[model samples]
Target: MSTIVIKRSQAVWQDRTRAYTAWVDGKAVGRLEHGASLSVPVGAGEHEVQMRIDWCTSPALSVSVPVGGTVELECGPNANALLALLYITLWRHRYIWLKPATTE
Candidate 1:
């Protein structure tokens, strides 16, 4: 089996108040709190993952994990204030941003 590590940081003070739910292949995996992370074991192959908070969600991300390998993901709020506001009111933009971690 492979592993997937999902993480989120309390980058913005406002975000510190909420924890996001991590999902893999449409199944709820666990909660990711600010500055915290979780690891889930899965069969080696492709999967779809995302994060959600309240009514907001991150775009589904497709990832492939090799046997005994790990895939890392990071979730956070948009940095742009204007876009952040839209994230609250527009479903299209109402999502946290999830991307591959830049560093291990």
Candidate 2:
């Protein structure tokens, strides 16, 4: 089972549109509109974590986690450093979250 823990520092729009997207291993996984918390089934093993909202110039941010491990990402409002943005974009954001690998 793969779970994503998100902590939002801002509120959704008045229309109740969060306009956020999460990607697991380069593939979009879950979409949260009016909600802040999201849980979804993720592929086990090492995978890339990416997320971004509207008005956000930069792409998704990432980190790395172990399999079967639950990772939490906090969304804060700020302009990241130039170098960081460039590096992150190369990896398509970051290298966050690690899902458990399945054994045959």
Candidate 3:
């Protein structure tokens, strides 16, 4: 057995009003607030992960964890531009981006 640490932060300062829900294999694992994180223990194998806020959701992320290994993932709103925000809000589009968390 291994642990998959799903670390998520509301990196977008403007969208801190809502908390994003982290989903693993279609089940709600935990809720992530601004500058928050969650740790999930999973068996050694592949898993599906995603973040959802309102009607928008990030794309399914495929992750594989080795025995006794850990995987770090991050999620945040794509606040790079105004149009992107509009697309996310108006179109019910997903502007949240998920990626492997970088070690600082």
Report the number of the highest-TM-score candidate.
Answer: 1
TM-score of predicted structure 3: 0.83
Residue range 1-104, candidate 3, lDDT tens digits: 78767666656464687788888888998888887888888888999989888788887899998999999998887655656657477645456788888989
Q: Each candidate's lDDT (Cα)?
A: 0.84, 0.49, 0.79
Lowest lDDT 10-residue stretch of candidate 2: 94-103
* Model 1, span 1-104: residue lDDT tens: 79999888677664777898999999999998888999989999999998888877888999999999999988887635656667776753446888898873
Question: TM-score per candidate, in order?
Answer: 0.88, 0.50, 0.83
**Decreasing TM-score order of the candidates:** 1, 3, 2
Clashes of 2: 9
Model 2 misses residue 41 by how many Å?
A: 2.4
Stretches of candidate 3 exceeding 4 Å from the true structure: 10-12, 89-93
Span of 10 residues, lowest total lDDT, candidate 3:
85-94
User: Candidate 1: global Cα-lDDT?
Assistant: 0.84
